[model samples]
Target: MFNDGAFAQITKRDKRDAMLINLVHGEPIRFGVDNERGVAMDSSGRIELVDVVDVGVENLLVHDETADDPSVAFAISRLATAPTMPTPVGVFRAVERTEYAAAVSDQVDAVTASQGAGTLEGLFASRPTWTVS
Candidate 1:
């Protein structure tokens, strides 16, 4: 929890119930707020809403306990030393196809090739001249 407030101010109604929730903590945190200050309960229970002007919270509130690691500090400490994912590299390769029709024969043969044999080296004894990157 932050030093200034155990709860972050969500909404405030003048002389009425102020809606507030607990900050992240290792304990099971429940919150109750007085117009003057905020209060926290470590044991699991419903959130307490006391009216600064009225009696209780007007809005329906539900609380759920998650299965996440209770220690936020420990989780952050582990993340600090975790390895980052590797950057992705781009790949480019040329397409080659046989011409089925007579008209496109010249165009198919003209499909350009470049210098180096990449993965195609086994198929072509000569330098595989299809452009690849």
Candidate 2:
């Protein structure tokens, strides 16, 4: 478990450093620390307590209603189906990294084909911008 202040600081730094990405049709999304702890951060930089055990990757799914648009449905769907587990930090990070890898894979085919090489660097370059706790 993370100390409250430590967790808050980590999440805040992550949120602050997150690279905002435009979803197809919803509000821009940024990668950051999320846990059973209610999305990890409040607008005021406070960490909200939550039932971590219940917060699975599925809960991070952004629905049309929550997203307020249809354009992002596909992306949200992809995110919804991403891997998730019941552990504290490692589980979420693994799921997120998996999702990030998949996202990068979508763009890697061309790079690998053109370069005639598939490397970790090439693959990582295609992943979503994110930070780990």
> TM-scores, in order shown?
0.19, 0.18
What is the C-alpha lDDT profile of model 1 across 16-106, one tens digit per residue?
Answer: 2333333343222223434332222224532332332332322322222242333432322232131221111111112244556854755
Highest TM-score model number: 1
Q: Write the per-residue lDDT of candidate 2 for residues 22-85, one digit (tens) a residue.
A: 2322212223344223222335543232344555443333222333334333323333232231
Off by over 4 Å in 2: 1-98, 118-133
Q: What lDDT does model 1 reach?
A: 0.32
Score each candidate by Cα lDDT.
0.32, 0.37
Q: What shift in Å separates residue 102 of candidate 2 from its native position after superposition?
A: 0.4
Q: How much is 47 displaced in model 2, in angstroms?
A: 20
